[model samples]
Target: MGDGRGGGGGNRPAWLQLYDLVGKIGEGTYGLVFLARPKQRKGCIAIKKFKQSKDGDGVSPTAIREIMLLREINHENVVKLVNVHINHADMSLYLAFDYAEHDLYEIIRHHREKLNHPINQYTVKSLLWQLLNGLNYLHSNWIIHRDLKPSNILVMGDGEEHGVVKIADFGLARIYQAPLKPLFENGVVVTIWYRAPELLLGAKHYTSAVDMWAVGCIFAELLTLKPLFQGVEVKATPNPFQLDQLDKIFKVLGHPTPEKWPTLVNLPFWQTDLQHIQGHKYDNAGLHSYVHLPQKSPAYDLLSKMLEYDPRKRISAAQALEHEYFRLDPLPGRNALVTSQPGEKAVNYPARPVDTTTDFEGTASVQQPMSANAIPGGVTAQSMAGPRPGPRQISMVGMQRMPVGSMAAFNIPSQAGMNLNPGGIPMQRGPAGQAHPQQLRRKDPAMGMQNPGYPQQKRRF
Candidate 1:
């Protein structure tokens, strides 16, 4: 493909003509993520290149869903979909997003391994608050971000929006307000470490509470620089359940009881596999032993509510924002990097590294791009094939674009036709061509970290 500058008879795909591919930043199950420079624009853009769909269709449903949902919602805390493009050559799909330089995963890793100091209280509080704020918007719109791990939470770097948190990677997100099928039929969702207890046990029905559970786990990680639950995922087709994961949770939070969680007995695994799950009886709560916050502290109180046993009782994102935790001194700020306290110094977060090598080159013979109606925001590739038109506008009619954007377990009744992972892999977290798990490094919280009692993380999900 020729650079956007009109070389090679200007036969390059329209997407290539609009954005100059800088280099590949990350690769995942979907495809590859490239750092792009809009030929006519000043700032950078992260272009996600999706591979051909399984059926060799025009675009994958995941990409379409992301584009449709992003176009409908407009919030500073939410990652914006600048534009959608197609490489006519292979019929591959590409999504353009406002580049965010930092993510909570990288930031937490940096503070732990590089600086060797805990993140300031102000920064942690601010980051959490912004995360909840964005989550509140999604919940209000009936969108449940099934995947809310630390890596998916992006932080802006070196811009007017620097230090601001942007909730990203919506491939696994789903609109829970109404669904044609049971939410569980979609299969496993959240990453294992951050997964809610109800999901592990196979609850057949669920709600927005699943997301709040993930937020709680993220909050714990921000405080400790390590995944709160580091259980090894069983790779077999289906055995009992996520025994190690449930054990890990039970070890810390104590086993669930029907009294505390009214619907506990209704879960399929609880009724049928109770013997296997109840290997170790835990009667007392030991969460405080790992997290050092005072029991009476607002932060601890909020965390407890978020990690509540019952999904029905788990704290909502909106309620979490108004909790006493944010009401305390050193309140959250818009820019998480900037300290909210009067005299604290802002932590200088390093910029994300970009790879200059490995640019994307399409393989299929060039073909006319798909119709504009199929693409999000009513933008077509053919319209971009012509000469450069003024300064490039990545997001045209951004907010006005399109309309805006589960659980349960149980049953020993019959295992036939369940949405079990026959391959035994965790659910695909993000889009194929988007970022993958390259930066996901396992750390031992027992070594010079806050949660020394917890076991070492052996593998990266």
Candidate 2:
């Protein structure tokens, strides 16, 4: 295990050289999860490798945050952080996880392409329930797993924990949030398709409901074997406001409005970003055409609540677990991969393709490039350089709340229309050469309120 902090690493550990290291099994926002087999151990385990932060000085802030927070989390459905190791020699930090043979993406893809086998409803129920169970625990403990997608979830192909569902990839997660920071500072989040309506509206502050939105998207994908809202993402800016992605959501879920969401109009980008499509015809009658679930069924009920446009109204993980969907005739099983009930024959999925070319010599050849589509709509989230910087409490003048004298007079002109960055809190300040969300330089005191190019009079307070 190499132990170099910024440049070179510590001496390579003998265990790393001895393990039957295999090729990559999966990739996530900040790291690569691969398979490895130790000569003395029984089965395979996952070696999640994290690259150093921006300067390549050491493990990224996101990796440290994940390693610290995940150490305290314990649940059957959650991927356990077995151990933390570092190779100072190469400045790489590795987290060991139980090797799950399959992820929901692979399972869904197998059914859609290679195997062409359909996933039974039982498997869907068990997988979703278990995933929710893990989520419920996280939310209860005040932790938000900001990234939740089909590929982020892992499942075993065999053993006592066999057929079990384990949620992975906490690189974008946050714990014990207080004096909330704007969500955009980190960079693109939740992949475009699963991103919630509020986030698209440019709500600077958000809640756990964002995760539920992703879960809803996952539920739909599991049933249909395809992304429900397959929108093409626009990467024009480092933080591009997701116009195209929002268009996709509006087409399927219908346009969000002040009538449906009272706070919808209050979002910073509501007027600046949403003014283009005010006349588009839409129906709020909902999800029936998209999901095959019966309109009145409990599954449909759960899906609808999960996809609620208003983050405040969206269903919580705990509430969703108690939904009638789980009370049906065939209750959810313990294993999502179990092909049959007890005492009956079983059908197990094929092993995932593992690259057998892991470097046992402890010398580097080439590093695998980060995959943007690792989790469908998920992006390689821009990670933070360090811990959340405390913002200086400014005077209460501009921050003061005032009643709307006239809605017509309060039009905000934004030069950066709906600019959205990846996950992570907007740090109060960033390193000298780095850029942070909260560090937006304000040249004009009026900020973006007045259009500099336009000859409009500044609002008189």
Best by TM-score: 1
Candidate RMSDs in order: 14.9, 16.6
Each prediction's TM-score versus the true structure? 0.76, 0.73
lDDT of 2 by residue, 13-61 (tens): 5445445554465555566666555466565567777766776655476
lDDT of 2: 0.61
Model 1: residue 340 alpha-carbon error in angstroms: 4.2
Question: In model 1, which range of ten residues has the least summed lDDT?
Answer: 380-389
Off by over 4 Å in 2: 1-11, 115-117, 179-182, 283-285, 340-346, 358-461
User: Relative to the unseen true structure, what is the C-alpha lDDT of residue 433 in candidate 1, on a scale of 0 to 100?
Assistant: 23
lDDT of each: 0.66, 0.61
